[model samples]
Target: MPDIDDFLRNQERIITTRGWAVTHVLPTDDDPDTTAPFAYTVGLTAHDHPELIIAGLPPLVAHTLLNDLARQVYDKAERFSHGQRISDLIAGYDAVIIDGRPTDDLLPGAAIARYGRLRIRLQQIVWPDQQGRFPWDSGYNFDPHIQPMIAHL
Candidate 1:
């Protein structure tokens, strides 16, 4: 896993260069700390920007922030029209890219379940095969195994 500090630094760099607002939640040391987990929800706007909504942000004490915003796409196919999409809530927001990599198991299941109702497919930020730039795939998506746990979230 990539060091959390490095991740946060990368995110800070992106915010500095791109000039976007970032929000992060930091967790306590204990596993499943009553304190919440460390994560960030970032958004961008020209000038008068709106607030972005994301769930399960702990305190902003110490946490990792990714410099490159990893794209987390919510596939429309997964959701019904007029349904909630992660993109809609955080529109124009860029995600901090995950360098070390995050696993589905580590993510908050409840929070993810909320999105699933919309049939959302949370995928990592990556260029489509047709784009053919680095030819490397980006983004890690949630798999079905996580579904059962979301109800509790």
Candidate 2:
């Protein structure tokens, strides 16, 4: 797995080069409860990584935040690069999240759902681990990987 720092840096590069905004939810020191900071949501337009990623959030919440961050990327794509070609961006990433599933997606444990009915809500689970540790090649599973490819509009 790529170090979280590498992943974050890569994402920051993509966001800045593409000129997109990133939104995140964070807690202030004043807030006694650090775990559930959802009472408020923070939206940042800057190109810097938020404290959450650097601080390392709980896995479940981190996954949800990643999803939201990705959605923001897509939304920004639609806003700024609407007609511009994004094939390079699409191709460069090891994977792309489609319909909540990652395609050519190599992120480990990225497809399994911890909060919902994974089998029903998720169609496939793909990751670098399937090909053995440190396998750089992308693998596709019929039920999981194909679902996202087909669902792409």
In model 2, which regions exceed 4 Å deviation? Answer: 1-15, 38-153
- 111, model 1: CA deviation in Å? 22
Candidates' C-alpha lDDT:
0.30, 0.30
Candidate 1: tens digits of C-alpha lDDT, residues 28-110: 36545343333433333222221122223323411222222322211111212112223332235322211212243334232
Q: What does candidate 2's lDDT look like per residue over 1-153, in tens digits?
A: 889678557655655664432233344588644322221012222322121121123335444544444455444532221112222322232222223222222211211221222322211111223333212234532233212121332
Whole-model lDDT, candidate 1? 0.30
User: TM-score of each candidate?
Assistant: 0.26, 0.20
Candidate 2: deviation at residue 136, Å?
41
Lowest lDDT 10-residue stretch of candidate 1: 144-153
Show model 1 residue runs off by greater than 4 Å.
1-13, 21-23, 30-32, 41-46, 56-83, 86-153
